[model samples]
Target: MLFRIKSFFNLKTKAKYGLPLVLMALITSQTNAQDNRSFQIFQFPANKIPTIDGNSEDWKIVPENYIVGMDQLWDDSGKQPKADPKNLAVSVKIGWVKGLNRLYFLYEAYDDYWDFSLPGLHNDTFELIVDADQSGGPFIDRFHPNPNLTNTMDAYFSYHGVHAQNYHIFTPAVEKDWTMVWGSQPWIKNLPYANASYKYDFKPGQGGKLTLEFWITPFDYAGNNPSRAVESILEENKNIGLCWAIIDYDDVNKTENNGFWNLSKEHKMYGNASYSLPFKLMPLEKQYKKEIDAKWSFKVVNMAKREVAFVDESEGEITSWNWDFGDGTTSTEQNPIHQYKEAGKYVVILKIQGPKGISQLSKVWDVAVK
Candidate 1:
């Protein structure tokens, strides 16, 4: 929930006690979304999930249309601020699985002068920002709920990336870790939340092509602890706000980067999520999907009365539905509410019919009650 911060404990207490429903509403609201929505995040089949090995063999199934090449990026920050393939060329491919709330990335790039000798942020980097639900606003520490705490470290701890996340991922990380999460919650970059692997044969300064594969979980409310964090649910056809920029340091001793190419036209996208480009989580390709298929999900309304709600999620043109509640009861309703008299564990079934064909699904012990 959007709580007005009055004191330090107020922010921590809200983060700790913020209800998921309200917090999710506050984080996922699209009131301010400026939909420059251009990219699609491909959905990989469950059996074809890509292994994070920094290899391109697994990503061959991804169509060429899903690629975002250097042509799409603008040099938002640089002396010349222009796209030049002679200096560097980069292409990015993104994918996601239906059940997993994570995004997989394959970054391929060739740079004439690959500079990453520094141990700090002074390196060739792929900077990214993701607002998984398109909840747009200043996520960084530029603004404050209370103006008095504007420049204080307390505000930095309480405000930076509370709704969105930014990552400065080194192209070929040297002695340092894979990325520097630009926020208070650095733990979000570790395993269970994120991972990375780089494949390259050249040294730090050598000019060559580099392949990097990684996956990260986007959160709407990622506080200090995972227990209170709210991971953004990935659903079909949802438009997420995402953008990236490349910070290329051609020379090791140069104080400034040679070029900064970003998918966004504005450089303020680093601190503002509203400036992020749109990325739709695309559904499975027709090649892997049935012309007509049956699917469903259930929500328990009240366990005390054994009341359950079933909703149809079938694919294609469905005309009718049949539901078997597994308690000597059945219904023809597309979505039905059923009540069980006495239940231990019961199997549920759903059947659907369309002009193309017919399909059915059965869940074993997916519904239970006292």
Candidate 2:
């Protein structure tokens, strides 16, 4: 009894969570709550990963419940609770695959005024910030935790976007790169780090709906040196921080935004990782759930008594189970203790059945007691 208590307390956190204990402590200490509501990011099956080719067909498999509509956003610049759909409407869906350290986004928006005539920041844009590990703190040099350093060129390279990344994504980039990563590591906005595609028909200053598909790899530490940068590890049920804003300009000539629709309640989400809301990396939908696997283990309870204890350790839901002791005897109990008439090496098998299907496991001459 004491051994069991000690084992539970002494278990290594790193082995259980795939993160070291010290790093977990640092993450817990740095985190801040900007938004109370938690959002869910759909887990796309590896085969169903959306292609960044301006197509909506691939995202059809995602359910509507995952949509983050304009209703959820706060108009930080416009100071409106919700934008008039006739003037501006937006919907966003985020996705992730199990092993890939990348985030996929499908952005759909309708604007009464599409202003992208400018060569630079004057255009309509989607600004995004992500703290992949939810290791929250200031990401920009201006808000650097180290108070003394001048928010100069030196601090820009050393601290800015090192813990979190920011991207000013062009809604429909005309003659420019798709996005501008707001830090020293501009490389993060290109090729292997990111890709974007847009589907729109209207000319600059014309009104139309736009569909933009994009994917970006978020980093825990991204500096000028890509070789030394650390990409955040994405896993099931973990929470990350993400904030985005839609920057709109009614007229192409103006340098300021007509509206800024933000996913976060606070405007400072752009520079502070703490202000980015928690987005959970959810498990796959029911249709994509893994099937049950039959597994079991046995220990000799008493050699003189010819008794053994069997344990069922199957994965996934199971309604029923059957175990074969290879001693011409069987049991239906999930975990059973059985006594054999004679001592001998015996093959053991366990079978589990659930809604998905049935699974069976067999061991040959594995369990033995004398």
Q: What is the Cα root-mean-square deviation between model 1 and the actual structure? A: 10.7
Tens-digit lDDT string for candidate 1 (60-106):
99999999998887775656566667789999999999989999999
lDDT (C-alpha) at residue 225 in model 2: 98
How does residue 177 of candidate 2 score in lDDT?
91
lDDT of 2 by residue, 1-370 (tens): 3344345435574467554664555444343232467899999998889989998999999899899998887677754556789889999999999889999999999999998877878888999999999988788888877778658778899989888999999888999998988889999988898889999999988899999999999999999999999999999999999989998788766667888888876688899888888899998898886688798888888989989999998879899999889988899999999998987889889989999899999998888878
The lDDT, on a scale of 0 to 1, for candidate 1 is: 0.86
The C-alpha local distance difference test score for the whole of candidate 2 amounts to 0.87
Candidate 1 residue pairs that clash: none
RMSD (Å) per prediction: 10.7, 13.6
lDDT of every predicted structure (CA atoms)? 0.86, 0.87
Off by over 4 Å in 2: 1-34, 79-81, 293-315, 318-357, 360-370
